[model samples]
Target: MRAIAPQPLLDLANVSKMFGGVSALSDVSIRIPEGRIVGVIGPNGAGKTTLFNVVTGAFRASSGAVTFADEPITHWPSYRIARAGIARTFQNIRLFASMTVFEHLLVAQPHQGAGIRRFLPARRADPEAWRRAEEALAFFGLAAYRDRIAASLPYGIQRKVEMARALTARPRLLLLDEPVAGMNHDEAAELRTLLRQLQDRGLTILSIEHDMAFVMTLCEMLYVLDFGVLIAEGSPAEIRSNPVVIDAYLGSEA
Candidate 1:
């Protein structure tokens, strides 16, 4: 079978967000093609996370607009955005400590309503969804501990589990917020491999990360934001040589 061509999956146009007297983002426009990974990079306080929050509706943009899959979704609620196939992981891990990993995946299936819910999980449980969930866990090699509580996993595997939960929801656009924040080099490398595997399988990813090596390897296009505005954008190699990006990230002494 022939593979389908990738298309524009998520688009942001002149999106700006503010909190009280602070302007977190200004006139930021970005287009993410399907099946590609785009990196969002910046110095501290560049509003990277703020942009994610705005897109996912954690906070409404004070000005400008946002759209997903061609429809206007500027200020939709978070759950609404999730239902629309926008799944995100936090900069810090957020998982139910006491819940088993399988339970986490099951709950993410959404309300199939009473008719579908009552005898559904018992009667084959939508083989496709189960297959996808199992596939994701197997990809991350977490199938062995499907019944384990989330908090009991090792840190590196915990990252995999969190990512697994996100994939279990089957999002079209996955917003990964520093998937390697607290990880060591080896752990980070593993996460990078998982992300690439996700992209190769036709997932569109927008990630916020500080690890330059990870960013350069995973993303073809890089968007740089500084002090609430996008200062530069280009290919990873170009971004590495960009003066504006250097000024934003490194001091002139370099």
Candidate 2:
């Protein structure tokens, strides 16, 4: 008897994106297995961010399909896609400067109900939302910073606050864009630990990062893109040795 293949948590089949005459992605395909960390790496203008935008519904693909949890989400609006359990952080920190860390988390919580109930002012604090927010703060080691203004924290701590906010959405899959972009070595190491903790908690992640060391160590598998095309996909070790990747992205580092 043949074994059945496990369905991917997210799958992109022959996806293509174009901005007028210029192609940002062409025939790109990838599968993110459930509960795994997958990395996408490329040089500047390699279309990594374009792929993310297409998947998250920020831009509809010019052609091909995007499916999440076995459902086709090709034409869904950005808000609908987010509501369907996909959450992401931007390449740049997107925290509300004036808001407290705790407040940021609170605002990210998905509200229950619809119509009048949704629009009506809450008469009381939402216990569930508060509980989730507190848990996220503690999990990310930001409990003490809960009342601190987001802009006043250190850069590393601000990144954690942004991640904590994403977590409050209770997503099954997390998308991170340059998550450790501005961190020092120690901060990056701390973030690596936090990412593993999140993975262990059953959250699957798809990340696009320029930090080669971080991604190579954290990701189970990787996809390499160049000029809107997927040139390779494999384990970190395999990718590190691929001559095409070395030439296009890694350069002398390889």
Candidate 3:
């Protein structure tokens, strides 16, 4: 008997991106199933962030297809892609300079409907947005910092606030770029637990991380990219032992 595979929540088919004449991504294909945590690891200049940009419609791929939730979004604009149940955090934390942590979350909920209304400020009277904001705040253990200006918070807490802001959108697919870039051990571990909880609740996550230990322990599958090419992919144990991965990216870390 043959077991059927679950349809992928997100699929990138032979995707490539070009910057003028330079190639940023070259015929890369990957698929992520729903409710799973996947990691992409590579050294600096490996096109990891570029890959993220393409997925989020920050850049249009020169070729290939990006299908999410069974729909092809290859030519969609960034805002349209985001409104279609995908949300992401940048490699560098992006927070509203003068907004409080709670306010940041409140402003991040997905705007419904079309027209000039979408560009207007979020409705302060919307209870559902407020509820989601509070839920994200509590889930991220950010209650104490709720009233503080988001940009003025400590580095680690700012990270939490950014993640919380993303969650308020209630995205089905969450893309994290170097999510644990500046955290201490305990903070990173706490994030691992939090992400697992989100996964258990059926949220799909894809992250690009240089923190090998964090990625190794947290991701169920890993993809290795080097010089804009996907060089390897496998389970954590297999990736650790893969000679090409060690030579190209992991080095002594492997």
Candidate 4:
């Protein structure tokens, strides 16, 4: 008998989004399988960020369905979507400058309560939460910097801090928007290793990146978009040689 394919961890089915009269995403569909790194690439103004926004509920789609782990989340609020096991990092680092690295992770812990209960002082530090934070710090090589203020860290470390904060949420799927942006080759290389480790630990990652080399080398599959439309989808090798993808974004170098 032929084998059946497993359902994707995240599925976008014929999704489209419009801003005023302008279409930001037009009939785009993609699937991210469990335990794999999937990449989305496009030129500037190609709606890559908009696609992320729609998936995370920053904006509602004009048409189509989004399902995560078999649950429909297309119309869910941003916070609701986040609480439903999705976590994301921004294209630009969004760390709390005045907060220490440890504190950032603490705030990301889910189900701490609400209203006055939320404000109730912890009688003592939650040992489990702190342990998780420490593990994340060590994993990202930021344990020594845990007590340091986020703004004081080097740019690459700040990016790691943001990623660490997201991991503290214990998300089922992580969305990274340009996670390697503004990094030197050495920094990017270091991050590449960290990402691979995360995947090995069973985290499902879907990322948007302009760093073609990084995306090509790291992602198992690639999706290319242009002017809000998906133009191509393939393995990295196929993407690297696709004439349409090259003309639209990769240029002659690809």
lDDT of 2 by residue, 132-242 (tens): 888888888898998889989987788888888888888999999998898889888987887898899999999999999999999999999999999999999999999
User: Which pairs of residues have clashing backbones in candidate 4?
Assistant: none
TM-score of each: 0.88, 0.92, 0.92, 0.92
Model 4 lDDT at residue 22: 100
Please provide the root mean square deviation of candidate 3 (C-alpha atoms, Å): 2.5
lDDT leader: 3
lDDT of 1 by residue, 117-213 (tens): 5465632756666677677777768888898997788877777788888888888889999877888888778778878888888889999998887
On the 0 to 100 scale, the lDDT of residue 154 in model 3 is 84
Q: Model 4 TM-score?
A: 0.92
lDDT of each: 0.83, 0.89, 0.90, 0.89
- Candidate 2 yields a Cα-based lDDT of 0.89
Model 2: pairs clashing at backbone N, Cα or C within 3 Å: none
List, in order, the clash count of every candidate structure. 0, 0, 0, 0
2 in model 3: Cα distance from truth in Å?
A: 15
The candidate 2 region of ten consecutive residues with least summed lDDT is 115-124
CA lDDT, candidate 1, residue 67: 81
